[model samples]
Target chain A: MTATDDRADAPAASIEDRALALLARTRRWHWAEAAFWLGAAASFALLPDSHLLLTEIAILGLFALSLDLILGYAGVVSLGHGAFFGLGAYVAGLTSIHLTAEPLTGLLLAGVAAGLLGALTAPLLLRRATDLTRLMVTLGVAMLLYEAANRMAWLTGGADGLQGVMIDPILGRFEFDLMGRTGYAYSLVVLFVLFLFARRVVTSPFGMSLRAIRGNSLRAATVGVPVGRRIIAIYTMAAVYAGIAGALLTQTTMFVSLDVVAFHRSADVLLVLVLGGIGYLYGGLVGALVFKLLQDGLSAITPQYWQFWIGLILVVLVLIGRDRVPALWRRAVRRGGAGA
Target chain B: MLTILIDGIAYGMLLFVLSVGLSVTMGLMNFVNLAHGAFALVGGYVTALLMNRAGVPFLATLPFAFLIPAALGAVLERTIYKPLYSRSHLDQVLFSIGLVFMTVAATDFLVGSEQQLIQLPTWLQGRFDLGGVAVGRYRLFLIVICALLVVGLQYVLSRTRFGSRLRAAVDDQRVARGLGIDVGTIFAVTFAVGSGLAGLGGALGVELLGMEPTFPLRFMVYFLIVVTIGGTDSLTGPFLAALIIGVADVAGKYYVPQVGAFLIYALMIVILVLRPQGLLARGR
Candidate 1:
């Protein structure tokens, strides 16, 4: 048949029609988004008594999300993100102790300090491509900070850390209670606001540029993206977020320890991101929840075996196919449908 | 002043022993094994346990100390590291970190959290007078052993077939593979050897620095700084970097006690900024 005749006879759609159809088919993602938010809100509301745990999860979730910005979006692997976190916490603690004792002011100071530090360090740290070099540079930075903190005992309180930090109420209303009721609410609010901001940044044109850079920096640079500038900006943003999270932690606990910048804290943040799945914004929050829950539950059950079990979990996660969760969930849904 | 220099040299030697293996693996395989320090800790702990608990002679325990960490490294490579080699650096990092946690936790469970001291044998215990300066015999022996290892490793890499293969693999894995060399075997063998060296360093250096459960985290930064500043792919870089860092660290601790703690990191930053490729580029 002639081409025109064939086209007339065949009930085929145009490219635009196909595109529209595909968009319609994928619109159900909106419902999935709604379900996720609803579940999160419900969980938050229902677990009112779990303020301590929830607050911790909130702060850590924010910290992990900050890491996700650089690692997941910008392709910078750091083992020293905790430096900013610890710096923020210490700044907040010192501010509260020696300055105004206001939580909001402390957090703002923390974020600004951390952001400046990240900006300053980015030029040198962003010069490397190999992950090993990046790891060492970041670790060295963190260790340097740790040593400075220890040596500057008069200012940082050394190994004792900045203790007895008393934070006043936010806006002179929400006092931090011993039960962590106020702390949980404050952290949750801060986390949600930051999440919203992060979501905006990630979905923005700038964030798309970051994703492009992450996928292939050489190609992105060839395509006219200023790779260095994007990296520095994203790195600074991540550091600021980490700082806020750290401030939240110190303000909530009313104490700041050198542990904030410790190696284990860095490792823990990495673990949470991995457990939650990198590259997804929700991954950090989910990973934090699961990790905190596991840590809390396992520690209660067997304090000594807590790390052992966590290590086992990490090992199993690594070995049993890192992408098994989505695959298994899909399979389970199919199986349920078939059974029904 | 003389004593500080002597102490710095001895400390530098110990650092060289711990960092050289890490430098080789980092240079050759491009593997970031965070568990490298864990092996060192294992070596120290095993040596200490044998000597302190089992009543084994200090000299006799050396073989066991080296062998135990070597076997551990081999087993770890087979089970955990092998799968991670081809994965992304992030995956490898996470997996190695898990390995570190498991090793540390297991060690803590098996042994207590208390620090264990390594008492040198009588012959290695006393101090020797050198030019009116009395230096510890153990430190002198450590310095000598470390020097020998460096010299021997340089020779092996320069002259031997295995070393040649390793150098080839490090320089260009794809080309080495094209040449029909078993890249996987080379990687495994290199990792084992690297870990064994870490263990040896740990056991030998225990007299200078006691072993503890927190040893991995405590010294991981030191080794990393050396490797980073010296450049990862150069064997001689870590050696030279270690000496600089060792001297700087000891002198900083002694003279400028205020900023002494952060001297190494400062040195690292300065070196990295000045020579980003490290002090030594990998030899062709």
Candidate 2:
């Protein structure tokens, strides 16, 4: 036998190569992603006037998306991201009450305040890769901020949170109605606009650098990524997103609570990200939808045992595996096609 | 002054008990078990349930309290943790956070949301006059138990085979495996032991701080600070760090009532800036 004939026994190299090539080609399917987002946005707009739940989902989706930016892309796991969110909410509430009646300006103030805080804390948090240490430090910063807000009751309205945040008409046209129609529209607009902005950011050179850092910080640093500075910038930007989301919630609801700063809130946001999948931007949106639906449905069914069910679901997710189920299904489908 | 010192010591010892397990897991397995506090909560709830609902004597329920959390820990390690041990820190953190939520929810479901009170047995109740200073006998008992546990742990870690295996595993798991040690079993056992210690701390601490649904998240920060400052692996590190924190916490509360609550965070930030490796660099 000739060398070529002998190499034919080398186990279908071309088949494997072809499969890998197909996978590589399908990996960058942006059209499918765009279609998915469009479908989600359309469905959201079509949802009836369920003001409280819809508004909450919108705001939380934004919050989760903010987290997705840093966590999914940048790989910075923050247990204190709520600090920015809460800070933004408080800032928005305070500004609307004390400074400007304009809801748009309130949102701007929130993002700016939260972004600045993120920038300040990023220096300290960016120094370590020890997840535990980072978790603790970020958590500590949040606690400190919470304590400060609690102590400065005179300014923050303390535990009562800022009340009577009168948000003026959006650009002197759309008034925030109590039925939540206006609120939902406002949040939807904000979410879509921010989503577009975030989408742009993720596709930018900065976003590429973030992904590079997340993949391999040491290698990225070696290749002139300025890993520390990138981390700080991403963290700060995430804070802005989170802050805006928080402000949106307050503006929509016209009230804010110290619960925004609570550790549970932070933990819940992280949970949402995990449930939806962290690396994908849509993960946040998906997680928020699933979590909020589960929470609302389960709580309505059994208020006392709702948490138990939630916990059980989480444990099952962890035990059964996060990514295996989908992968297995895909394989099964492919095999079925091959057989056909 | 003596009271403050004693109170601080007692509080610190309790913190040390709760945090050492977390420190070991973080140091050895490189896993951030957020559910560490959940184990403590489990111990507290079980003990409280038995003592109050089951009408079991407080002293008698001690073994049940300890064993329950230990078993739970083993199950958690085997089922949940084993798979995630090799995962990224962020994933582990998320997994543990899930565990925490589940534990809290389960506890709340099993036991009512109302805070459960644990009455010290008649023998352990009340005060003992300490040369003109009155100290609670239970506090003294805790002090004694803590001291013994610390000494015993130090001895085990320094002299025993399991200790050596644990150290080897922490240093390098592949190398330890090459040396023929059952690394998986060691990990499970270590996790159980650590969890057991947390339960003990929880059971004992119930009297000092009542058992409530919010205890896990509320006390989580304090525990994290202790473990973080103590450097996650060294037994003495948590002990010493807890003392410093406990004392500082008390003093801060007394002097600066406004920012008193944040003193620990300030301390944590300072430590992070100065010695990010923790006060006593986690096990070499």
Candidate 3:
């Protein structure tokens, strides 16, 4: 709130201080990003048989990151982000089947298709609405897509799922093998590229405008910011990122299903962002890693009821601060140091 | 068509009861409780269990349905939900959604994942035709009970002194508290009564809407649709909204058959987009 007020008094700040603040806020967690990539690379070597799961984590990370773009930064709480993901997936799957089998082209096509949809849909949804109305609009759109997918079985393969999705080798190089090595590498590269782009997006002037809008849209508008255009831009971009993630999933897994657009996918991504903490780029990366591992570990013991444990964890996370896990850890460490 | 209309009205009535609690809580408390469906699930299970195992008459089990959820709502509101009253909508959404997941899994574990069916009493099993519209005897019973409940609720909310106190508390908690209104007690009671109504709806709806562990997740959208479209604050708004939705849905399914639930979502989006404050906007 004060930041927007400071906009009018911007010239008062020293050049040195402004540069330092920019650097501090924009590139705050370089080490965390390094750690994330290092861990991801290391996982490929350490766990020989877990490429598939690792690939899923990468996909989930991207999905959560896309959610983080609008929800984390722009303050637009969407409950139907999976719509873009599913659209990307179905597009990629259908493109490979009908148009071309090339991975990159299909991914690009998916992104473009989902982005266009977002651009068209954003105006209708980004109107002045309460949180409840926004949730309904997003959820309704997703459900409509889900229903369409379910009903259009003639084209989508309906309940049986979009089978026989044949994808070509990555850049006419490494092929998608049975153990998912190529897929893992491909997804990781895409996630990294998109993560960097997202990082750049969130730290730019437009990103600052988004945060301003999130903090106080009215105030931002009064301060000469184009709030609506910025929102529409970011919303479309987020949809594009989510579309790529969906395309990645379909390309890697070689399957497309209605679950991609399911409500739970949106919920799960939100959970990932929550666990990792929002408004930070690496929160999606860290949250996805932990959530996937926890799901895998917990499901092994109770395959049929892992949802209960996840639910329990979510409840605890909300009860405690969703973003305070790191703070709590630091506090405990400090207490131990003092006691010792 | 007439039969479908009657059936839709009955369905809508059931939806109003199930969703009215959610509308009330969201309007008064401004908390997004996604777990409202879970209470309805609880009530349905209670009624189903009582009828099946204890040989409790279908009507006899209804009271317990309301009582159990009301009691549960009271205890949970005090222990779990109270702290979240002042939290942001994000936190509230997350907490309530988590509650929904836990309750769904718990119910699944407790009462097997299979659908639970209730045996209607012999009197309710018959259908009568009135001038070409064949109305189920049980649907008529449901309509009568739900209509009466709606009237009772409207009376309590509009006419009673407690209603004014609750409204004042919702309008401005600090101001109401300053004026000597026990805001906390009113909230707890409202929440309990709301949950009880949801339970009653659940018990009655078991025959129309199948009861299972997935009940919460499956019908969560419908509950939200009713609450959001009807306007979060008013009783009649949700009531009318639910009727419109239920009728549109039933008629759409009856006529088209292929596009299940498509019409309702479309309608909800149109209504919400045009009237973001809900169909019945309160002048703030």
Per-residue lDDT of A1-340 in model 1, one digit per residue for the tens? 0233345444678744554454454332444455556766675678878889988998999999999999988999998999999999999999998899988899999999999999998887666566766776787788888888888899988888887799898899988898788898889889888988888787666886898888899999998999999999999999999999999999999888778878888889988987787886776887898899999999999798678777778777877766665355446546766775
Alpha-carbon lDDT, every model: 0.82, 0.81, 0.87
The model with the greater TM-score, 2 or 3, is 3
Give candidate 2 regions above 4 Å deviation: A1-45, A324-340, B126-129, B282-284
Second chain only: TM-score per model?
0.94, 0.94, 0.97
Name the top lDDT candidate: 3
Candidate 2: C-alpha RMSD to true structure equals: 5.8
Reproduced native contacts, each prediction = 0.51, 0.57, 0.64
Candidate 1: residue B246 Cα off by (Å): 1.6
RMSD of 3: 3.0
> TM-score of every model?
0.91, 0.89, 0.94
Per-residue lDDT for A1-340 in model 2, tens only?
0223345556666744644444444345454466656765675567665666877888898999998898888877788889999999999999998899898899999999999999999888766666666777788889998998888988888888878889999999999887787887788788888988887777666776898898888899998999999888888989999999989988988888888888877878887776777776777877788889999999999887776676666667766776653354346546766775
Tens digits of per-residue lDDT for model 1 on B20-138?
77777776667777778898987888789899898898878877767788788888788777777667777767777787788778878889778888777789888888989988788
Local lDDT at B45 for model 1: 82
Query: Tens digits of per-residue lDDT for model 2 on B83-155?
Result: 8877776667667767677677777777767888877888788887898887878878888988898999999
A best-first ranking of the candidates according to their TM-score comes to 3, 1, 2
DockQ of each: 0.60, 0.51, 0.68
* Pairs that collide, model 2: none
